[model samples]
Target: MSQTLTSDQKDALQEVTNIAMGQAASTLATILSTFVTISVPRINIPEVSEIGSAISKMVGNGKEVTAVRQSFAGHLRGEAIIIYGQEGCRDLADLMGYDEDIDQSAERELLLDIANVLIGACLNGIADILQTGLTFAPPSIMAERVIINSLIDPTQLTWNNALLVEVNFTLEARNFSCHLVTLMPEDSIERLKQAIDTFMENF
Candidate 1:
């Protein structure tokens, strides 16, 4: 099935995402003790088969990366995947004062910490703005030291289409960067549209 949104709906979602991402970035900056720059949130509704490719294009291909996964449910339900490049991981470790004796497990912990902050803050912002509630499962490591293209297998997904919201967070001075991609299934997409409509009506 094809999932589509009207021009007005798209604009509303983008605006909501921008505000939410800014909150996430701010939270991250406070933790990292540096400025966090965020890209304008890019939203897309793509078929299951194209999900992997679309994400690969966003984060680039053939670069070793690590990712963390978290699922949220309630008025809004979906999964959030945060992809961090190898260099980005190292930078994060150093910034977080993990430079000494930083082993594999320590690195994974760092990635999860970053994911939790970004995903929780961003999704919560959206939920609050939409006047809804969301509960998140604990963040976990999805992939480690793998290429971006291999991060996810779209063929294994149960949904034929999904609404994807992509946002990038970068600490240019520290050479740290990551992508936060949120995938809401078809049913949730319909619910989100209704929520956005309600928000617009109150404006």
Candidate 2:
């Protein structure tokens, strides 16, 4: 697997992710009825084995997290893992019209709902820009209040390399935040390069 991306390729992927992130933020904002803010989407090309450590660093320390894992396939194929800090999950639950007292079922429902919206919108945005069709599997709760290292099992890697798109989201009103990490397979790199080439030629 290629360990790095060319400058132009990185630029093209970042542009694609930024556009996707913007659309995701809009969708989340509309869902919660509040303004949502997203940071610049960042890309990381890491071996499948190192993804756990990468996620740990992005999630920081002393925070328990839960993740919803969803897979998408089309021109690109990979998983979208949305990790929410436990405290942030409670805030999000409240924002979504759930009661302040959240039980296990409520939390699960909240996580799945938010994950479906954010992951679905972002992936669709990428598919639209790349002009590729994509279908998603129903999302499932991967981990609950677990450490990042345990959230992903290396044994489940379907590919050798991963394109990690790190997007940080914040709801200003509730002071809630979460990290949405989209892991695209090795083939996505080649597909993205071709799409970018076509996109540039058409411009």
| Alpha-carbon shift of residue 57 in model 1 (angstroms) | 1.3
Tens digits of per-residue lDDT for model 1 on 1-203? 65678888888888878887788788788877889998888777666678888888878888889889999999878898888888888888887777567888878876788899878877887787668889999999988899998887887765445666767667856556677787877777777778888888988
Collision pairs in model 2: none
Q: After best superposition, candidate 2 residue 89: deviation in angstroms? A: 0.7
TM agreement with the true structure for every prediction: 0.88, 0.86
Error of 1 at 181 (Å): 2.1
Counting clashing residue pairs in each candidate, in order, gives 0, 0
The C-alpha stretches of model 1 lying farther than 4 A from their native spots are none
Question: Which of the numbered candidates is closest to the native, going by highest lDDT?
Answer: 1
- TM-score (C-alpha) between model 1 and the true structure: 0.88
Model 1 CA RMSD to the hidden true structure, in angstroms: 2.1
Per-residue lDDT of model 2, residues 59-122, tens digit only:
7755689989999888888888888888888788777777766678977976898899878877
- The candidate scoring highest on TM-score is 1
Model 2, position 65, has a per-residue lDDT of: 93
